[model samples]
Target: MKKSDINQYGLKPVPDPKGNSTGKAAGKAISRVVITIVSLFFATLFIIGIFMFSYIMSLRGEEIDIDLHSLNLDYTSFIYVNDESGNPVEYKSLYGGESNRIWVDYQDIPQYMKDAMVAIEDKRFWEHNGVDWWRTLGAASNLLSSGGSFGGSTITQQLIKNLTGESDVSISRKLKEIFRAENLEKKYTKEEILECYLNVVNFGSGCKGVQAAANLYFGKDIKDCSLAECAAIAGITQNPYAYSPMNFPDQNKERQQIVLSEMYNQEKITKEEYDQAMSESENMNFVFQEATETGADDTINNWYIDTMIQDVVSDLQSELGYTKEDAQNMIYYGGLKIYSAMDSSAQEMAENAVANDRNLNSDPDMQCGVYMMDYSGRVLAIVGSSDEKEGNMWFNYATDAKRQPGSSFKPIAAYAPAIDKGIINYSSIVQDEPIPNYFDDGTAGPNNYDHQFRGPVTVQYALQQSYNPPAVRVYQQLGPQNAYNFLTQKLGFTSLVGGGVDDSNLGVAIGGVHEGVTVKEMTAAFQIFGNGGQYNEPYTYYYVEDHDGNVILDNRDNISTQAIKSSTATIMQKLLTTVVTQGTGTGAGVTGWQIYGKTGTTDIDDNSYFVGGSPYAVIGVWTGYQNPSRLRNTNASKSVFQSLMGAYLNTKQLKQFTTDSSVTSAVYCTQSGNLAGPGCPTATGWYERSNMPSECTQHQNTNTTSSRSEEEEESSSSNTSSSESSSSSSSSSSSSSSSSSASSSSSSSAA
Candidate 1:
């Protein structure tokens, strides 16, 4: 009864044609409404997605840091060298690679570089967010049947891909890139992003960026490159080899004209300027010298730069608290401003000195390092060379090398210290004979350079003559610790080699240490003597500036305290001076100036050194066989220092510059501790004065009874009191050293 009642509303359990028709119609209507709503929602979502994606795609990619310091490069290794007189010299590099290229900001880039790039790669680069929608659409439509397999990616898009390593190449990918590019545009100014792109994008031919390409295409840096040259570079972006002036001169020229025309059409350049540029382009002789593709054997090509890079990394870690990656980035991409002390002229002279030498050039087994510095202890030039490979300029002996300095180490270790202590004057007698038990051990035997000795020589003579036995004898009395301290602590040297001889003996004096010394160390030590015994830490940079020219680090006025006594330095100077006048350094003689230095030759003649300074410049030169074997018998007789000096002084480039206007010269008697010379005929001499007459030649003598002598007497009296204070200070220093050691031990224990 209940079932019938429930069904009765429909009347009976029977199929009603009207009811079935009504239900079917209702179901169909509901389905249609659902489908319509879903379709509308999806259409709305798709539109929104497209718009959002477009907005995002139009955004600029993140600002890539185009700072010069962010790239992997040698910042201070640039080509500018100057003497103390502020006279610049040209530093020439034989290896033409990106290492020599310099970066310019987008704003500073010549209109031609920008115009050419826009002309070839993306005309709308400055105008687009990150993508050119019209170009993309056109490319897609053109390649529609091929599924958007076309070429319309803008410079900005390519930059993003290069930076992010994104491989996606779909319509969707393009859309996403546009959105990202738009974001990048927002985050970075157009100038900044462009700089990043220009510095980072690959231009083929082993060139990763435009700067590298500029160097590869043109032997000069980007700043020095001309408009036609810029056009040639721009012409090659599409297909570097296809348009490379080196491989396809005509194609490259045609491409360059196209760039010039685009630049003209875009009005990036004035009509007259464009016409001139085009005219110049016709005669633009791109000297298409192929850069030595050294990446094939990274270990062999320019190993010096690699070693320098390692030091640069270490320095960045110490100075800027940067990781290895951060240092690499700083060098390759940071756009850092690096001011180096390198004198391009001196460097060129140094390089040519090695390259042009008949003996060195003929021998494929020679290695050498040359360094130059101003009187301020700042390095001005460096030449790293090792045996030539036929016509290839490949080897670098400067930074990668370490070799014994020989007698060159004596002036730094023995003479400087003795002068500082006032123990040995320039005229003090030093008998160059067989050193009797120089080590105070029966095993000790004194040896001379050629197994010969000069007898009863002055301290200056011994040093100038590079008499090894006298040096060893002098060192034996002074103690090995003195030499070690002078080298490591006073001279600021690094890397100490061990000798079996005890610190109590003369082994240190005779260059007994087996550890190799870097050219940097030799250069720095020489610079200290030149700079009045003040240790100006060798630095490549004078100042660092931000992109906006804000100084980050400026060491222009910074100078360290006196490392050795002025009197000691004076004696050492006199002796070194004689080196040029009468000894092994005769070839280094400069007629118009006073030059002082020591010549060094190790046992078996593996390494030879010349470290010297004038009021103008300090220079260090080293020569050796590639395998560290004895030099050729002919070379063995030849004075390495003399050769270096002859090359340095005779170079036309070096002759053009003057010393610092501020420098003043004078001489003092080393033995009597006075302004007059000792009784030696050669010792009595005229000291230089700022305004001495050309013929004025007399040593300023002092008398105890003279008025000036009274003043000197008073000054000496005061100095005696100062010395008493110094003695007390020495006691205090000893206590402090002991305390420091205790504290260090305590800290270690705590750790």
Candidate 2:
């Protein structure tokens, strides 16, 4: 017998009995078969009812994880920043859970859309108590004739399954699901149930719910959806993967017609509506966000996005009284609109600058990190890795990694504080020799690029040359604990967890703290010089608002503090300018911008760093292997740093550095580093009004030669150290540059 015939009716004898002798027995056997079939069918239903009753009793002692009363659903949150025109632009979006649902309120849902969903999913969804008796009877009738499995489930039943996260095909699962669905219908209103069904339902393309679907396929808000789009969204619930509006537009076209036809038949929509929807579906063309130039790959979380997430999460905990996990959940599902501090132009420039692998001049295994921010502590852009972006929520080198800053710490840990405390000035004489009682053995050795002492040098000369001994001498005078206090308490360097002993030494003079500094910390530390002694904590977002547009957290409360005296900062700023114009940082300067920064290379040349500021922004760049090893080339870091600096220079309006009234310039003796007298060789130096030096009557210099040389200025760019021990230098001077050029050829060939 055919399957259709068996489904249409109970078991019947095939072709009657061919022979007459066994006809009586055949009739008797057929009667027995029909009776048995009917008995089993009713028995199964009876068994299902009894099993559900038992399940209810068992549930009295043990509770399921799902709490029906809560009925919570998560939605996607967005990150935005105002563009040059001052209009908000979305930079990144974060979904609340693994399911990327963007919730829409019932009030925002269109009426026709609701009608289409009901007409297609469950026609009597408004009347049925979770399980539709009429539909169940028809499905049972079809099963009896065709031996087909049960395929009728109301919207309530589907919702119950979705809530429980259960997909078992067993009879027990089906019965339990049906009873729970009935319970759900009794407890919740039809509008509430329908609203949830639409939100939690998957629509493919990594989207869940009507809002995500509308945003993805239609590029419009759910409130503005057309009847045709509504039908398309409703059709996807049948099988999202196979009938996704984005992935399978053709299949969706056919399914959309079924939904529209059902809506029309049920009188949920007018004939005119049906006709217009049908016409619209005939030529439906889906538009994806990735097709636009502004859209980024949603799977990739770049540096700015990662930093914003960390900042928002931290603020959420403090401001809203939420745990870290809870705050994270609220961010993803709460439909929040976070106004971030990211500048789109700056971010693009920074990512392009660091991701330019060919210009990096190192193996793919080598990495680079960059952090950029303005004077107000608003983070503009951050690049954490050198490798091509592959996925999201990655390790951010800019914010997470605490690598040594090399000589970069000279300005922050030693010179800045020294000038602030009145222990040193722009032209103060410092001895370039070993510090006493600095080590556990009561002996100390100075670290230098060329491993040669320059004897007595002025403070400006020592900083421009990145000499370790002078910084150590000054660090000693400033006192290690005092410097530590200035770094942690004033500049907010969290990595200097000295615990009283580890960091109380000379290592900090050369970027050797107990722990290292993050690129973010190092960048923020430079803000004192950029903003005339003010240090504002680096932040990524301005504020976050709830779904209804009420402000929930305000991050604009971050205050700027006077990290150093304005006069001291002014003098230090001028000294840093000399580093770029006449010292190791010349290679990192942009043409029209007055770039003032320090260059630092480790004693072993394993890492290279450039931390500086222009009138527009403060930039910090680090290049080296993730594991501590000598750099292949240190020059590449400066080039990368210049590009990041140029990004801000070329985009923002140029503003000159603000000079304090207490800062003044004077001519000083090149030899004595004191006020110049008659017939004394002199150079200009800036000093605070209270800290001016006395006249240099002791100097009688006849030589009119320049105090610094052009050849020494080029040394840092060329003489880079390596793992093969080819050379050693901190921000190389020309002495090692020429020597290493000849020595590195042999090392390269041997390797």
Candidate 3:
């Protein structure tokens, strides 16, 4: 033996004297290799076992206890409105209160549906303990081959996910799901798990559970679902949004075929049944449910409920810090009790008033909206449209529709702000003559509705008659930016058009806004007059309680902010009263009640509006074609207002408007808007004591032409009125010709 061949042990190296040492060495090396491989295999298995045990232990502390019996498949929240006695009356469901949502037990579900679900979702659902290892391995293989994740979740595992809300697709989430599924299987029977899965799974478009899906898609109960319908519903479980029959009909039909094929391959359905189902699915005419804009099922014909649901969801998100999805889920499934200020009698009256109006009912395309609210801004009633047809039922014209308010917006955008700023009083004279193009360009100025000018008139008469130029003058005096801020910020008119001061032109005073106004907004704004200048944000629900009877929102004493001086509101209310008595709004007057409001008829008669109310209730009525067409009758809204407000006022005691001490009244010349002289015609005028104007100066015989008072002169008054008078100074001219020439000159100045 050589030194190099000696063992490292520093001992004499021995060899097999038989010359087979190499073979023997090789054989020993192979044996050692085998032993090492076996050891590594066992070590790997031990590590995996430890890891699984730790993972299982990690999930053991997680709260997985769920009250299965307390699960309410038939639970639905309700919206309660006040009855005549002021007690809460159940009006409708918070979630399709009138919709038919059937909850059937596992036995009641059609066998075809069960078969289809098992075949498409998990073929070995019946035999598996809680997971199907074979299917999981196949899924992993498929994932690797397709470079995408695949679902291998058994029905029990899905049930566990639904019950525990552990829906994340991570390793820990998968492990927890497995543990929960096993525990669930141990605690409940296979049939019970299936039942829970069918009842808890989410379908598309806010539909939950197999029963809801069956009704929403087929308009039938689960037990009555045909083979094709069953396959369609079962397929939707994979990707509800992608395979929704209403949204993706072609894709849903394709998925349905896959479900039918799976059932046939699994021998769950006969070949003949599969072929028939496939054929039917190819030409399926799904009776899909009509959903509101918020994606709730809209089987019931109530736009108010739809808007209320949206508002409730918004309140939940803003007031309670819940996500949009969470809030909607709570509304539909949390079984909350919502109390609203909706007066059922008022709602019925509003609806009937619009529906039965001869002007609105004569034209199918004509739509009318009526909204009523108390002085505190609690919505009493809302009628979105006169007709509730498929084409128009979803549009909430009262709150959602934005139409030009015409003169109805004058009080809010102009008079209220001007009065608040002490810039004008009811007795302040505004020249009702043609205004020149104040924009300094070649644009036409505003004209009265009849294209006729009435000389100097009091602010009371200007508002009552809906004189366009007077409002523009007042708006200019208040400053366009100041008026815009007051309207958009102070009064909460969010829908006004234009972004900057440049867009806030004189037209805004006359409702020539980019997106005019809604009936609800107008009504809410008008309520400020009745509420002594306090603006309470209009709301439907007074309070809301969660499923656990915890009060989430209590809006009974909602905060009210001062929009204007109480004296200003009082003076404006007095002026509005005269509108119903002697102005364009006389038709809206109810017997024995002092009604006040302004009438609005837009350019081309596109929209008609009459917004007014007594001290008890403020109501707004709007009548127009949805597509901005010419309306033959501009006073149709007045009629509707008269009908609804008449009924509403008749039910309550005639209440008088409370006068604020700061508001004062004085006798002034109606035509001159000044303190009455011995020979001047006079009318009663209300004014804010601080803003009352000086005694008559413009109408005095000697002072008529001696530089009219600056406040009484129109902001855009040119020498046009004087120039036209000079041309007609000839006595030889016929009286009618002189009148006609003066009118023509005024019209030319306006243009």
Candidate 4:
């Protein structure tokens, strides 16, 4: 080595021994560092992978234990209870769909649908666990070359994203979907996943679920769907409206044909089937109403229904435990099964009557509100307008409106009490001349509808003619409190009293003073007589059961307190019967049945009503303008009561109940409110008036005819009195007490 020192003496050797040693040591250090860094990176990735796996596994369906029995989740917007014939009576829309979304088991899906979806969306659905590396690589290469995004997602991955509501744009998001899909694949069979996937997907028009889409597109059930229709539906999976036949039929057809070709290419369908589907017609008939420009302005085009919705909200908040948010959510989201009492037949009739009435239709701006109910106080049907497309603006007119009842409130206040107290028989005599009331200004008097006095007339005649003067006299004699008590305390009406009125009296009786009356309250008062005095709270929901079929609430055997003696109710019934058969409500009489009803028209013609009942049902109809202004061009000549009766009396729903023969007769007095008695003297009049005797002095009287014609009038009067006195009695002090025992038993059980 000393001899080789020539290398050091000359120059530092490129191959120096010490240099070699240093290089070796440096290499060792670098190698150790590389190994450590690589180890840390892999360890971090492993931990992350483990955590992700655990998280996804935690979200498996089997791990979920939601209480199906206590979902308290209302899905009202998407559900409507069916009628006895299994036909849907109402339509509910949630998620912007036309109707409810129904789910079917995986095994129920047609094999063709599964095969078609697989062909179009993911041919390798079964082979891939979550993500396919080969597909991702191919998509990546295509994206780089063409600068367009390409989906490499499998069916499992798409389902995971849909069910979990995960985003799909970013790589990280895609990774999460992959993990979820992997977990889903492990927790459920392929069939279950596919079934859920099809149901959870969205179609157009706010529709969700395959069943809804099938019905909406093809007007058929999923199981019965045609190949052409299936192709159209399959084409919609990626972009619903983009392939909507409703909007773009020709384009959608082409799109459907493309799917059909894909199905054929993937061996999901036979060549002949694909060809037939491609050749099938794509004609779609959609109904759209035309709009008209008008000079007359209409507020609340659907005020009837809108008003009802508002009232419903109020009721839910007040009676049920629901907040504003809760109510809104329930209407839009909850799948609640609401069995409305509305009789579809009655509703249809009311709508048709109002629509076809030339007088009403002449004024394009005019609208009508009609509601029908069962004697049990359950609302059977409601109509706000003749045309449903006009919107439900007419809704809730029976419950939300506070209008003066005009003469309609008269019976509740005056006649009902007079008959109850035996103040006068149906033929009692009364003077229709002016009777002064000392008002705050110390000058007031009542008048007839024509502002003229008819002078001396029987109470029956006074009410029949809707004479305000006689109503006032009866009110004065009955005392204001007696009338008020009869309405509120006896009839269970809550709308007739309140505000500044200290006692419900003559003022309330004649509709001269009142806070306001809703159609519901006014109509319900009459229903009490229809139901023979039972007063149960009105309800729409019959029962509520959990997903597991456990009962949460049941109202099948509901009952309520008796508001009046059955005998008293019978008396009112007889008086009302007179109204329909021979009085102002004559238009409301139904052929072949004993009908009872009342007619009310408000001041300025702002409102008009006809409330009536049969043994089976009670109905109320309202016509007016919401602006408190008189309906322009209205005659006030047509009877709204007639329209409602024409509609309700013909309904098949009413035929379900057997007729009760107890109700009969017609023509009763308003003052004394009974058959002709000592107070009344019948002179030639309607049969209701003639079926009485001279004994009812307080009920009927002889009309003073021209002096020159006295002889002939006297002969006619004699004939009339004999028949009138025996006509009918509005009092039934006997029937009500007899039925109380059975009613009490059933009602208490309900409570």
lDDT of each: 0.56, 0.73, 0.71, 0.54
Candidate with best lDDT: 2
Clashes of each: 56, 12, 1, 76
Q: Once all C-alphas are superposed, what RMSD does model 2 give against the true structure?
A: 21.9
lDDT of 2 at 170: 53
What value of lDDT does candidate 4 attain over all alpha carbons? 0.54
Instruction: State the displacement of the C-alpha of residue 201, model 1, in Å, after optimal TM-score superposition.
Output: 11
RMSD (Cα, Å) for all candidates, in order, is 21.5, 21.9, 15.0, 22.3
Ranking under lDDT, best-scoring first?
A: 2, 3, 1, 4
TM-score of each: 0.50, 0.62, 0.68, 0.51
Off by over 4 Å in 1: 1-313, 386-395, 435-441, 453-457, 497-505, 633-751
What TM-score quantifies how close candidate 2 is to the native fold?
0.62
lDDT of 3 by residue, 1-751 (tens): 7655676556666654677988889999999999999999999999999998987898865436785656644347878887777888887664433243345688998889888888998899999888898977776787679955446779987776555543334567666766777777777888887777887765664566778787667777788989999999989877665677865788889999999988998998898888888888878977765433224444453555656676787898788766554465566666788897777778778878887888777777888888888888788888887775332124677888988777777888789989888888887889877556433332334656556778777787677666777887888788777877887777777776343432366666666565567888888888878879988888888899977789998888888999998998898888888667766676788999878887776655767888898879899888888788777666678889999999988888767889999878887765566766644556677876766766775456753433333223432342222111101011111111111111111111111
Compose the digit string of candidate 1's lDDT tens values, residues 311-363. 45466667766644345444434444545555545655655666677766667
Ranking by TM-score: 3, 2, 4, 1
lDDT value, residue 519 of candidate 3: 88
